[model samples]
Target: MAETLTAASSHGEHAHGEMSFWSKYVFSTDHKVVGLQYMFTGIFMGLIGGFMAYAFRMQLAFPGVEVPGYGLVSPVDYNALVTNHGTIMIFWVAMPVLVAAFGNYLIPLMVGADDMVFPRLNRLSYQVFLLSAIVLICSFFVEGGGFGGAWTAYPPLSAQSQYNLTPLGSSLWLVAVGLEFVAFLIGGINFITTAMNSRAPGMKAYDIPMIVWMIVVASIMFMASVGPLLAGAVMLFMDQNIGTAFFDPDRGGDPILWQHLFWFFGHPEVYVVLLPATGLVADIITVFSRKKLFAYRTVLYTVFATGVLSFTVWAHHQFVAGIDPRMAHVFTVTTLLISIPIAEMMFVYIATLYGGSITLTTPMLWALAFIAEFLIGGVTGVFLGASGADIYFHDTYFVLAHFHYTFFPIAIIGFYAGISFWFPKMFGKMMNETLGKIHFWGTVIPFNLIFIPLFVLGASGQHRRIYDFSHFPNLSAPWQQDLRILATSALLVMLAFQSVFLVNFVWSLWKGRKAGKNPWKSNTLEWTAESPPPHGNWSELPTVYRGPYEYGVPGRDSDYWPQNEPN
Candidate 1:
């Protein structure tokens, strides 16, 4: 095995040494580079989304005032900012960072493969994603100033350029979204195929790392649910430009059909991003807490249950959309039932941490925060899930608060956790832990402060879609306006503290301590490879002998056991 690895390493070095910069970084087929591309691009888009949030929140808090960085926030501008903010964060930021980037980077290394089964397809996926982002950005500069019908793009508003007032922007928005889905569809296939076919010899399905399993399941969920949305996007695009009224009720079409199509994928889309974040948390907590994952098979089963139940709950979103009471009752049951499996997964994570040697490292902090914060999201969701409560809460700040509670943990905190955990391996250097903890406290505290006020405002009957609360006498009261100001103020603090993270990330890349392989003393196969693994992940591929989480085996000298290590 050593001899084989030595020869392979020598060959990889020669080949990598001969490649030019463009071929190496730009057009490279290396999964790590492709993953880095996705990560950086996602981060860039996150900034745009954040800025949009700042602009709109400013409009809400201090109506008709010009935002500091962004100029005046007209109603049209407010709509555009809100619509694109949601769209960019979900499609561009969350999917890419949580699924594509980490999946591409971790799968091959953890599974003991040198590269993905179809390398060219992987490269094409990212290229398509980048192009889609560019198209979405360009829509902002077009004649109509971006789509204002909201990210859901409901018809009448989304289908008719007359209602939306963005003939060009709405179509471009649809096109960009369609292109983004295509990219993920391609990437999802690669993730599933590679994990299935490319694992090192003797690595059984049960032996796979939890993060890899979560990514694979997430990809499957995405592929399964995305088909309907893709078809809908095309139809909606045609409706906008080519005179099709697929979603136009006035033109002999059912607008509700678009809702069905959108939410069909939309609710599952929540779990799609969610499962990957859960997976990241699972791996991080287990490693940092120094314990094997509690009830590994059970966790997998619950994930499967969550994915299946995710489909049934989509209709719950339409309860207030004029769906039947009978139908709403059925969906309400399913929505409440879906919580059981997710709750079980949370308990399982807590069980794993119960008696373990807990380390409050940066990554560990983010992982723990994911649980605490997401609990608030899940508990609050029960209200919105019920038909009776939803009628009042729907489109209110309550729903918005519930959404941020869920997604902030899933996307933002998840990204920070995974990146902090994998920074050493990805960049061959250790991050500054002091700066990391500072960023974590700074970010998480403000996050809660921002959303909790929204929750209160929402319960006070403040609607989410309002351009200015001053227009509504009841919502514009002193107390309610104060909540808006508080939430907006918290958002500013959160955004400002992000610079600490930026400095830490950039500085640590070149100037921090050099990290050797297995900095975390992890047992996963990825940790067995070099820090910032080379073109070929390992000179000699690993052969697995055990499951990933094997901490504190009674008779072992070292506390953890690597999957590739043979007795």
Candidate 2:
């Protein structure tokens, strides 16, 4: 191991070096530190999003009733909460933690490169993201509280200052989101370049870990898809400030154009967030199953297929938005067709588990739960994807429940699996497994408790985005009221459970048991480096000998074979 470290460091200017605190942490170009920075910031923003959800949930559960910590939420406040919560959770929280953080940290290490192809750009990415986040937070303090035009920031309402109500905050929200896109563009380019050019010797395209491949594919998809929306956002910004009529119907501009642009990016945007998660879950499933991943190439091909199909299906979101009726059929077919590749991937995962020596590790638990939860999400999506069913379900709590099912598994559960699986490698210590399992069950159960009832609410004809339900007798029925309270209580339970995870994460960072290299005995190149890999991951570049998953080989003395081992 020491020889391996020495050999790795002996190449080029890749030796582990010391630095001042500010240089090492504050403005460091080290991908690992930058990754952690992204993760912690994302976690903080997720909490804020959660609080926003809690406030709105309270309003839903007990209409007009003031909560203890926070006062009664006004309709304006509720709208702002809805808009900002969706924005923050998806962009600030999920994207940063899952994509930016993990992509920076893992791509080079798994591919056997010392650092990102553009290290300084990597640092710049985080800095710009931090700036965007700060700007968004500042938006909340502006004259009208915060942007209340919903997360989609749809036009007509979002375009015109008079209709939008929160002009200053909405303008800032556009700026913040646009800046976020720019930061990601920078980071996405880095991911593509590094993955394409930075692999160690013998690491071919097929040999790349599924997670790395997914990240690369997602970056490409994001780059390709985000352009129109970025243009739309800029146009919307113009509409907000300069009286441009880009999306304002009254000014002879078509509001539908913004819908086209936003959903063009929006639908694929879900896949952009999802692919990395699926990849992370893929890696974790194989690691704990102690088996080679079943159908690796097939899975990789599905990722490519999914990325391509994602662009075509974005119109599904515009189904109920008064697009050409004829076009709705085209989109409905595309939407349903997109599910086939995804279903294939899911089947492959289940097949991977068959006959494998599955270890019920905390990461494995999260991965399994992700599969189950995501299945529900996927199945429910069919209702929304079909133009006919969407008419009935549109703007209902069903839509909200469906997305949460999808995103929670991808963003929340998948992130937990990655964190639990990689905590040892990242921090050189083992997280408390007892607490981790507790957190997992605590989260999974309460999460379902919260969202499952929402499906019922949606079916009960309770429309979404309603500030107060007291006036609608059908929606305000006693039973519906009870269900809402149940969901809110479940949310509180989930929050309490999250505290356990927070404590575990911080406590484990400093005091947990030491983790030696390759603690999980996995085959990836990341484990070839030291736990908490040093600056410039390898002292000398290491070569990959085989694919990422080589577990449970027949006739081998050990159940797992590291990718770098001599054949």
Q: What local lDDT score does residue 114 receive in model 2, on the 0 to 100 scale?
A: 83
Tell me the lDDT of candidate 1.
Answer: 0.93
Instruction: Report every candidate's CA lDDT.
Output: 0.93, 0.91
Model 2: ten consecutive residues of lowest lDDT: 5-14
Tens digit of lDDT per residue, candidate 1, span 1-567? 435443255334333566888988998888899999999999999999999999999999899888998989998889899999999999999999999999999999999988887888999999999999999999999997999999999987998877888888898999999999999999999999999988888899999998899999989999999989899888988888888889887889888888999999999999999999999999999999899999999999999999899989988889878998899999999999999999999999999999999999999999999999999999999999999999999999999999999999999999999999999999999999999999999999999999999999999888888998887898888988888899999999999999999999999997999999999999999998999998788877888999999987889999899999997
Worst 10 residues of 1 by lDDT: 6-15
For each candidate, C-alpha RMSD in Å? 1.9, 2.2
Q: Name the regions of candidate 1 deviating beyond 4 angstroms.
A: 1-17
Estimate the TM-score for candidate 2.
Answer: 0.97
Candidate 2 lDDT, 136-209, residue by residue in tens: 99999999889999999988888776776898999999999999999899999999999999888888999999
